[model samples]
Target: MKYIVVKLGGSTLEQLPPTFYKNIVELHQSKEWSPIIVHGGGPLISSLLKSLQIETQFINGLRVTDQNVLDIVEMVLSGSVNKQIVRHLISAKGNAFGISGVDGGLLNSQPVEGAKELGFVGEVVDVNTDMIKEIIQKGYIPVISPIGIDENGQRYNINGDIAASAIASALGANLCLISDIPGIYIEKDNIKHTLKNITKAEVEAMIEDGQIFGGMIPKVKAAIDGLVHDVPEVSIINGLEVDSLIAYCNGEEIGTKIVLNKESSYVK
Candidate 1:
């Protein structure tokens, strides 16, 4: 019953190496860790929209999806990216089943607070945890695409990180956010180094000091949210590295582990 939710960024999805797939297969076959993949296709979706002469817009990092855009999003995410991951895993001798939040109401959500401004963007309110757990227990790795739906059949595009966090939170599973970089970097003796373990307070202070900025903001924020939601573990790992996943599964720290708090010190 050891489950880990791996959130693959769009960049990782674009260049997921064969070793990565094989590693996932190994983890699944070993029965030590049940890995669930949640993936995004931002670049692919954007490219398709451009090719079709569609206008794409984003607000606060959330895509403003219209009806036509939603159609393409679903096609690229649930159809293309989802299957592609499954295909790669299957090719590596792994059993995988691709699905979306919209299918079987896996992620029931309502329009994000300001739906009028950011059309069709929803935040997950509920997750069908039982279904996902069942899929995993049945020996099928559940590869999820972050496309959610409301009760009235209105579909909304979800941020992949947020979607993964919600699912992991619901299942009380460990979450690994696959990032382009190795991990959180800190300057040590005039040289920058990655922090192996960190706490939310330390990360917040780093952000305040401008040490953590740019695209990494959302990731650290998501990690904090996962911790707040009672997820047992959360880490940011590099998807490009061949041994990252395996190393993590073996408990040989390969990324920045986000913990609820740091060790307390007694000030004399």
Candidate 2:
């Protein structure tokens, strides 16, 4: 079976409409492709932290997850957002199971020792794809939360984008990142959407030209990483559009396709 890994950003999920969920249900019912969902809960976690009166900080756009903040991250990601995605998928008639990086030692990680201030923030060192494959084989979509456990058995908050990329690379599956905007734009305020089939070289040029900066930098990097790691292709599609995913997956020209230059000849 053709398998795809989708990473849904927390910002995109919060903005997702009912129609989007319905479309996902339809996609799940197709029986043509199997999908594994890795989701982020940054926005939700931030809100919860504020409600609990915790100060938040970021180092290089990654949250500096202190011990208290880590607690909130666990609660919101594994507890609320994970279950919500599962509930929505199940309601749409798709069999969905929610799991965390901590569950079954799915993702083993280590602290980013270079940054002393970012407490409990980790980078995924390894992933176990056996359980994921088993779940996919059973026709169940695995909804994953981006919470990793260190070798010392301490839970650490991981960046969702990194988590998704690691998982996709391990599974060697086509990866798609669903977000609120149409794929990476050449000019942020240009208003005219330019969905070019990009190569890693083009992405680097865009970054040098300041077109890709800030939040988009990491996202584009993740997509490029997937392409380089033999995943075949990775795409960035707008989550707000109900049929965006289906259109892209069907090669219907919906979003930006990031491909290695070696593979460009086959895209057309």
> How good is model 2 by TM-score?
0.90
Q: Score each candidate by Cα lDDT.
A: 0.87, 0.81
Worst-scoring 10-residue span by lDDT in model 1: 259-268
Estimate, for each residue in 1-268, the C-alpha lDDT of model 1 and write its tens digit: 5888999988777777888989988988888888989998999999999999999987656788889999999999999999999999999999999999998999998898789988888889999988998898788999999999988998999889889999889988899998888888887678768788888888888778888875566668778888999999898899889879989988887878988787512111
By summed lDDT, the worst window of 10 consecutive residues in model 2 runs over 259-268
* Segments of candidate 2 deviating more than 4 angstroms: 188-191, 262-268
Give the clash count for each candidate. Answer: 0, 0
Query: Whose lDDT is greatest here?
Result: 1
Candidate 2: Cα lDDT at 158: 83
